[model samples]
Target: MRNIKLTIEYDGKRYLGWQRLGDYDKTIQGKIEKVIKLMTDENTEIIGSGRTDGGTHARGQVANFKTTSEMTLEDMLAFFNRYLPQDIVVKNVEEATERFHARYNATGKQYSYYVWNAEIPSAFERAYSFYYPQQLDLARMEEACEKLIGKHDFIGFSALKKSKKSTVRTIESISIEQEGSLLHFSFVGDGFLHKMVRIIVGTLLEIGAGSMDVSAIDEIFENKVREHAGETVPAQGLFLDEVYYR
Candidate 1:
């Protein structure tokens, strides 16, 4: 069997998320798997680097599947793009080592959240960005971002109720850039739990809006209480920007 790596990009506004749940539910994985079955006659399982929440977008989501077919990678890529829905695109395909597992071998991930910080919301970008009419303090948000960087337990910021798996993850960097009426937030992290990035972004926004103190970030980290954290922002603003592997 040959392992094939796929770099995918999707709008994800209409799908139920990345994972395939049942035959009826619309999903990114389910759509691609259906195409693969038509091409190879195998119920191939596509293992993704991570799951993106419903309505979330992705620019460079990675997945892998093993196949017994001898089709060329170029043919496979073309086949996927041809059969899959218009919203999901298989950007690239490559032959991967047998030992390569998309989820396990992934070293880190990059995610970005966008906020429309203008009084007049953007009509075209409504589906892609969160609209916040309030003016935000960029300096305060930057200070909160500094407190979130480095290794820390992020359970407070995640939606997970309980788990034995370690919630501690390393956030290498968080950058906030403002261009016109848009605010772009980027995060590079070893890993993230469910809704972790959204929650952190919400917290930062609150701090910027003067509703929450910047020092509250440290308290949330030290207390490890989910209630102490800010709301989990809307999924539409979040994007799985890239998956890192080495």
Candidate 2:
């Protein structure tokens, strides 16, 4: 058995998400699986590092699958690129240890949320970035971000009602950068709960807009209540930049 790892990039606008659903729904996993089946004529199951929500893009998503094919890494990459849809691309393919598991072995991930805060919206970037007309106070947003770094209970940021696992997660770093009319908020963390990043971004946006103070971030962290956090930002703005493993 050969475990193959793939670095994938995709435009997530049309698909339901990463995971494969029923035949009625189209998904990223399903598309890859279809192309795999076509290339190797083997019934394979591909597992991703995580499930990106609908409309969320990915630049360096990692996935692995076990296959019995005799195809080489180069052949597999070429075959996938030829067969897979244009929206999704296989950036690289390599053989991995049989014990490799994409989700379980992941160490950390980095995500970025892009905001277009200019007067005129670009027709091409509208699908990938969130457009905000208001002027955001970047310094205030950075101050709020400083409070989020470190291990903390993020129950307030997640919307998963039945999430029984501990919400304590470590955030290694968070930074905000601006170039021209584009503003990017990036975060690196060990793991994240469902909708946690979006909610954090929304709350920070509120702080930058003067609708909420930086102290409110602390209160939400202390309260561990979802209602105390700001709204969940749109899914289009979030992108899974990379997944790390050792």
TM-score of each: 0.99, 0.97
Over 4 Å off, model 2: none
Candidate 1 has an lDDT of 0.93
Clashes of 1: 0
User: Candidate 1: where are CA atoms >4 Å away?
Assistant: none
lDDT of 2 at 29: 95
Q: Could you tell me which 10 consecutive residues in candidate 1 have the lowest summed lDDT?
A: 22-31
Best by TM-score: 1
lDDT of each: 0.93, 0.91
Model 1 deviation from the true structure expressed as Cα RMSD, one decimal place: 0.7
The candidate maximizing lDDT is: 1
